[model samples]
Target: MLNMKVGESVNEYFARTLAIVNKLRANKGKIDDVAVIEKILRSMTSKFDYVVHSIEESNDLDALTIDELQSNLLVHEQLMKTHVVEEQALKVTLGESSGERGRGRGGMRG
Candidate 1:
């Protein structure tokens, strides 16, 4: 949702991302599978990595006179979006899996 046009400082985008991630975490209960959940959390890091590399390789940075310290702020923003989307998708998958597990066990106990 934090769609900024050209020349938007990465810092602004990053703050918005952190807000959203916090909101999501606040809503969800402790996930049962820490390993799988951790993998989902890893998406944020991967997104940051991609964004930093992209900006570093961008024409905006390459021709710069200054030693551009690649800010992962905007990268974090993009990563947060990806993380939310993936988290939702995984939740759906887990819900379905839980349903299947119940059916496999012959439904609820009396």
Candidate 2:
């Protein structure tokens, strides 16, 4: 199992995995989808622990396709990135004075 390295994008990780799987297939390794899915779920970084757990609990690994798993992870990755950006923007806005602001979406923080 090739563990997803820290800071590695999901697409990159998937590409590397597919490459390895292809090589195995070329040599008649008889690898299967469930095996690949389990390996990926096991090999993800700790940041994905919750998502991995959710996937395992919610889906039948035997029936889940690799594409489906990749799509799920990609969505989670995008959400994570959006959340980080929102947090940083909130920090910056909070750092600025209220009077300097023209318009904002969020209401008063209490």
Candidate 3:
């Protein structure tokens, strides 16, 4: 079991979790926050009090056994897809706003 010092604060634990999440996101070629949820899930019970809350809330570990890791790759893939969707949505919204502003300006004059 992971052990953490008794005086460690929750905020510090969360910060560590965020760092791990960011690292995982970087590995997947995305630089966004979508992976945060999953990272939080993994951080729970991390050999210390900093463990993520998600895992504790679920009360289910049978599904997380090593034998199940391969099957769970699909879940990771879906997470990546979700990140792409969010990134694309942000891009689309920004583009639309820019276009509207351009139209409001009555087009560019030569």
Q: Rank the candidates by TM-score, best first.
A: 2, 3, 1
lDDT of 2 by residue, 1-110 (tens): 59999999999999999999999999996899999999999999999999999999999999999999999999999999999999999988886766556656785688
Error of 1 at 101 (Å): 8.2
* lDDT for 16 (candidate 3): 61
lDDT of model 3 at position 88:
100
List, residue by residue over 5-104, the lDDT tens digit for candidate 1. Answer: 3444455434554456467667984433333222322333443556546554663442432113224354467667798999999998998887654455
TM-score of each: 0.31, 0.86, 0.31
Write the residue-wise lDDT of candidate 3 on 13-76 in tens digits: 4556556656767787674443344443454333332233433455355335322332343354
Name the better of 2 and 3 by lDDT. Answer: 2
Backbone Cα, N, C clashes tallied per candidate: 0, 0, 7
**Runs of candidate 3 exceeding 4 Å displacement:** 1-67, 100-107
Whole-model alpha-carbon lDDT for candidate 3: 0.49
lDDT for 26 in candidate 3 is 72
Worst 10 residues of 2 by lDDT: 95-104
Candidate 2 whole-model C-alpha lDDT, 0 to 1 = 0.94
